[model samples]
Target: MAPPRNSAVKSARPVLAPLSIGNATPSNGGTPFRKPILTKAQRKAAPASGGIRRYQKSTELLIPKESFKRVVTSTVSDASKAHPMRIGKEALESLQEAAENRLVKTFEAAQLLAIHAKRQEIQQEDMKMIRRYQKSTELLIPAAPFERVVRELAQDLMSDILFTKDALKAIHVEAEDVLVKIFEKAQAFAIHAKRVTITDKDIQLAVKEILQ
Candidate 1:
């Protein structure tokens, strides 16, 4: 005998139903909230971006398998916290070193007189435009090294730039004044030592050796 005549018609396959927010029964034993009171216009407008008919056709979420794995991993890690990615000690040390280097560079940049007021030193290597960079952080000159340097350089911008012979002479003059005072004290010591031939050469050599 032939198959039943209606066998030509396709069998209706089971499909997952779209969730209904308004018509849903509460799963937590709480009484379901009454259906929303939507206006005719609102009812006609779709709550789902796609039609219910289209969503019914596809039960799979529109996400990649890799993306789903990432989502599941994050959620599981958050909930159970079973698997944790540990950063190695070496990696941590490297990161710390890199951070220190950057901080050093930043401090160095801040010490430039032109940039120090703004706490950013412009470097020719960086070729960063001075106009483009705005002063953000406090540009503090490094205290001991810069206190005397900035005070003396106020008279000349070039003093802050190139180390010219005149700039070195200015530094030498300052040093000479300090040395003169030191020499007077040394002379008093020298009298006690019974040495008068100990001239400025001895003083100069003594100063050089001591400083070195």
Candidate 2:
């Protein structure tokens, strides 16, 4: 008598052994993944976002991120006050992005300037050409007149102290920086007012808001 078909089929099937936790392996032959080991420099330079990475051979950053952000906020605030207009979130973000791009390009141009001067370290003078610009022909103040005004202001503040050549040059540079920023803000005022020409009031308001 032959065994029942069901009993024969069961006998022919292979019996599997139970897997132990220590000896269990994945179905595929690949090894288990582990975290990557980072070098000291990599660890130090890691960004908080972990999004995009920019690597520089030198440890120095072209501009401090926080300082750049502060400048952008201040610029936006000044523009708002000059125009009595509000900026949306998207516009604010766009301004920040544009500012960042400008900063990078400015630094790159400054680096080229430094290289042309055969300097490994970029100095303030190397960045002068990158920063130098005239917003309006009519607003251009003659260098001599600007220097004289700075001298007068210094004398008034310091009880007529003698100014050295370097001191005078530094004062002029600082004054130019201040005036340029004010003029740029005033241009926004003119545009907001829908006028082609910037009036004295625009300049005054710009200076007042910036000072405040």
Q: Which one is best on TM-score?
A: 2
Q: What C-alpha lDDT do the candidate models reach, one value each?
A: 0.52, 0.68
lDDT of 1 by residue, 1-212 (tens): 88765734554555565444555545544455556798987765545646655844875443454554565556656876665654455664554456555654453333333343443335553334332343433232333464466556765755455555566556656665567556655554554465654576557755765467
Candidate 2: Cα lDDT at 159: 75
Q: In model 1, which range of ten residues has the least summed lDDT?
A: 131-140
Overlapping backbone residue pairs in candidate 2 total 0
User: Which stretches in model 1 have alpha-carbon errors above 4 Å?
Assistant: 1-161, 199-212
Clash counts for the predictions, in order: 1, 0
The Cα error of candidate 2 at residue 47, in Å, is 43
| Alpha-carbon RMSD, candidate 2 | 20.2
